[model samples]
Target chain A: MDDPEYRAGIIDLLGALAVGELTAFQRLAADAELAPTRADQAALAGMAVAEFHHFEQIRDRLTELGVALDDAMTPFHEPYVAFHANTAPSNWLEGLVKAYVGDQIATDFYREIAATVDDDTRALVNDVLAEAGHADFVVDRVRAAIDEDPSVAGRLALWGRRLVGEALAQAQRVAADRDALTAIIVGAPGRPGMDLAELGQVLSRLTENHAQRMAKLGLSS
Target chain B: MDDPEYRAGIIDLLGALAVGELTAFQRLAADAELAPTRADQAALAGMAVAEFHHFEQIRDRLTELGVALDDAMTPFHEPYVAFHANTAPSNWLEGLVKAYVGDQIATDFYREIAATVDDDTRALVNDVLAEAGHADFVVDRVRAAIDEDPSVAGRLALWGRRLVGEALAQAQRVAADRDALTAIIVGAPGRPGMDLAELGQVLSRLTENHAQRMAKLGLSS
Candidate 1:
């Protein structure tokens, strides 16, 4: 807590997460427009609302820490915007897969990072990562779509792969730009951080979880 | 409560309100993109989420009464879609005014109808009508924009009028299509309903409030 570098790292982490949630809200709400039925639209809108609530929580936390909400969020804005622009879904099913696979991968990454943060920050991260209870809705719709037209599965599976690839690209860009954030993950003087082996394990775990999520959607990773 | 016609009217009212909230969520969320700043975007997104929450409440009420949620909402869908399509804001300021003026008008109409419903329905209607606390945000922004560029006011004022006009046109269409909803307002035998004079008063009040809202936003109605 006394370390200036650690405090800076925590701020960067919170900022990144806050912006992530905000963009997720925007993207999901936009995707809801592509929904085939009003019921599906409502479901996607519910998820968007949940993301906005999570964004509010992180915003409040940032405010409590004496950080300007906009200042904390601005640095990560480009990365998130670029990611969404590059991976914008062409249709509703692609949007569903992006919401499902993309969000879970981010959640898994944040959960891992949460392990390395202070108790208070860890709790906040975990709390926000808690699913909005719509995974089954996404899974159900995606699976039913595939069942009805097995041919679409190939294109969707490729979309899933593209989502993860773009997410990682944006994340790496953020990590490269924010040394304080990477320091928190990889270690600084007098700080506990993941060693190379442990970092490999984290990446492995993230990949494994991504594959499982793809499978859950009845798509190959 | 035992009058089948009255029951049908109540369902129609709730259904109309539910679909209204649902579309409001979609419209607000869509309009959030036109926001010029991240703060503005978040503000609009917050309002959208609030509308969705209200939608959920009306939805549950409809379900508890054993009405199918989709069926209750379907009849009003076309009118809502048409209203939004016709009045879609041209830019961020237009979007804000539409949100503030347009939503207030809808709220005012529902409140008037609320006065004629059963106590339970009245409570729910009032509960959802309670503002999401962002009126001040919209008021401040629209007023600020007008102050910065006085020329925009005439255009915005015209936009506000168009919104109200489009809203009235859709309301009439809904009334014509849903006899039960109209019967609730105009009254059926053995049921209390608004007399023509009372209906005129309701319209006057709606208009007055709309003007007040427009004035608050530095626009004319």
Candidate 2:
């Protein structure tokens, strides 16, 4: 937070997160409509509402920093928007899997990146990530769904892999596009950045966690 | 609150409100996508999130009453779904107009209905309806849009009318189908309900308020 580059990187990260949450709120609300039952709809809507609150917190932080929210968020909007557009769920199960897997990946990325930021920002990020109750709800729904129809697991697992691929591709694009933001993560002067080896470890951990999540949902990732 | 008839009516009212908020949450999120700018999108999403919270509160209240939420909300779902389907906005301005006009009518209806229920239920319904800041945001957007193109106001005014028409029709259908709920508003044992003259007065008040809202938007109702 001291260095200008570090600050810009932090803003970029938060902006991306805010926009991601905003869109997630929209997509999840839309997805809730696809649920066959009112209970399922309410569960997904609850998750979407949680995401909306997170977005508000991050956006308020940006405003407190005297940044124009749109300007701060503009650079990162396209990539996240494209990610959602490219991975629009085809059915209710796909929507649930997307919500579950997509949120975990984002939370994992946030946690990894939080380590390089200042204490305050790290705390904020951690608070957002710690709201994990919704994940279990999604997991239970997905597991129950798969239990009812085992054949669908294969398609959903494929959907899960596609989500990961699209997410990583978008992440790379954002990193390449925003040098300052990338510097915050990969290393810049006066900023604690991840080294090549550490980066590899992070990726391995993310992939392993994703695999475990898919397996937990009775899917073969 | 103690009478079974009163309790059943309260449950039905809360159930309808819950489903209304759920569908409103969905529709507003979809409407947010039509926003021309990030700020507008965020504003609408904020509105959607508020609706989600209200849904949760009403759902919880129903659960407290030993009513299964899905069963309570299911009957009201179809009418709301049909209403939204019939009045889906064609653009950003129309969306804004819809949000503004639709919310006011719903709030007005809630206030009228709140008068008949017990104090506790009245307070809960009033709390849900009292969230008013989003209206100002929406009003500003609608007025600004009208300023940009006067002709657009004509289109939006018509859109607003269609929304009210569709809303009233569906509400009538719901009232006809759910006699217990309707009885609470029209008349119930020991429940001070609206007489014919009072009902006419309520209708006039609703229409007058809607017209004033339209005029505030620089539109002829």
Highest DockQ: give the candidate number.
Answer: 2
Report clashes for each candidate as comma-separated counts: 0, 0
- lDDT tens string, model 1, A170-217? 999998999999998999888879999999999999999999999998
| lDDT string, candidate 2, B112-150, tens digits | 989888888999999988865888888788887778888
TM-scores of chain A across candidates:
0.99, 0.96
- A86-106: candidate 2 lDDT, tens digit per residue: 999989999999999998888
* C-alpha RMSD of candidate 1: 1.5
Which is the leading candidate under lDDT?
1
TM-score of chain B of each: 0.98, 0.96
Candidate 2 regions with alpha-carbon error over 4 angstroms? A189-192, B1-3, B188-192
TM-score, per-candidate, Cα-based? 0.96, 0.96
DockQ of 1: 0.67
